[model samples]
Target: MNVMVAEHIGFCFGVMRALNIAKKTKERTDKPVFTLGPLIHNPQAVHELEELGIHPINSLDEAPGGILIIRSHGVPPDVIEKAKEKGFEIVDATCPFVKRVQEYARKLCEEGYRVIVVGEENHPEVIGIIGHTGGKAEAMNKRRIPVIEDRDRIGMVAQTTQSIENLKLAISYVVERVKELKVYNTICNATYMRQQSTKLLAKEVDLMLVVGGKMSANTSRLVEIARNEGCETYHIETKEDIDPAWFSGKITVGVASGTSTPDWVIKDVVEYIKNL
Candidate 1:
């Protein structure tokens, strides 16, 4: 069997930047370093950081005082202010792309347009973006389009990891429902490239493997994309999740991973396939 890897695989610029900032903060700080949430979506990567003395805390109350490194998913402005009030030193590691989405959302809200974020409502990134609008923005997925009045001015920005197709659907739904519509394509360029590469590779391969954290939205989307292309696809976080039975009679395997996935994890998956 041959293994074909996607052209765009593993960590994107944002994830790498967040990880770098976390590592540097650990190296320089004597105080306990904490992230309000998992620094990134990858559990393995988060575990590695814990080994280096950077830990994830669920809430500010959990930490008495220390350096708080914001995850790649930007948080609301109020959260930063509250963290300051709690005496925690803030080290923002928000991805520039995500920050842009938040800025657009805030701008739209200030300009008298109803802000709608195109992504899962419960997602940390989406939640953070909504907070930027002072809790005025509502998050909507393709399946759950927000109701808009005919007289309403609608302004839309998508979660950075959102698929283009979903964004388009949301835009189409809102445009007809509102009098004036403004939309920003906030999907990350790297995500689009990865999805496109995975779709193209799935067509030629007998089996497709997506590697990344199960909690990663981008990774889940890759799995969905490959499966939608009619290829047999399995999402795995590590080599241990691989089932040899799935490879039976398969001649070519295509491998793709989420932006949060690390190179070492992808390398391990590729090596395992080569050995098989």
Candidate 2:
């Protein structure tokens, strides 16, 4: 089996920063550490953190103990407040890029612009961004831009993982009609590089494997890109999940991982395929 790995596989700057902050904070603090959700989507990584006494909790209602670590995607403001009120010191690991989107969305809403969060609804990042806009932020993600005929002032902010091409298409959909248009090109540079490199890799390989947390949006996007190239694609969280049958006949295999993925997981997956 011939295996080729993406040039950009594994942790991007944001995920690295979040992990470092969480780890460093955990090392220093005695208070039990908890993330509002999985710090990154990889169970192995989460389990490692758990070994160090860090845990991920699903809801604020369930979290009345320990220091609360905000995931890479910023939590809702109310969650933060409730955490603080509940006597949990907050270690915010929300990516700066995502924080910027929240700020921009809040600013746009304050200025009376009809805010549109050009991203997935219910995603932690999008949820935080929308909360900033008082829930007026309509989702224009995944090639689904709606008809906007009446808003005099329209503003757009993208989900950090969204592709540049999709962002442009969404903005273009609204540019001509709205008298005032505000676009904060919030697509993080890490996302763009990963997206471009993944697409190129997809074209060159017979089959593609995207590795990351199943809950991770960016990893899912990589799978979509490979599928768009008309190649067989699989989205796996780790080596154990890989089906040998998928690569049974393919000579060339390409592997790409999401920003949140760790390098070791990708390496293990690639090595498994090569050994097969």
Please, what are the lDDT tens digits per residue for candidate 1 over residues 129-247? 99999899999996676778999999999998888888888988888787799999999999999999999999999999999999999999999999999999999999999999999
- Cα-based TM-score, every candidate: 0.98, 0.94
Total backbone collisions for each predicted model: 0, 0
Top candidate on TM-score is: 1
Question: Which residues of candidate 2, in runs, are more than 4 Å off?
Answer: 142-145
- The sequence of per-residue lDDT tens digits that candidate 2 reaches over residues 126-224 is 889887777777788656667788556898899999877778988888898887898999999898888888999999998999999898899888888
Count of backbone collisions within predicted model 1: 0
Residues forming the 10-long window of minimal summed lDDT in candidate 1: 139-148
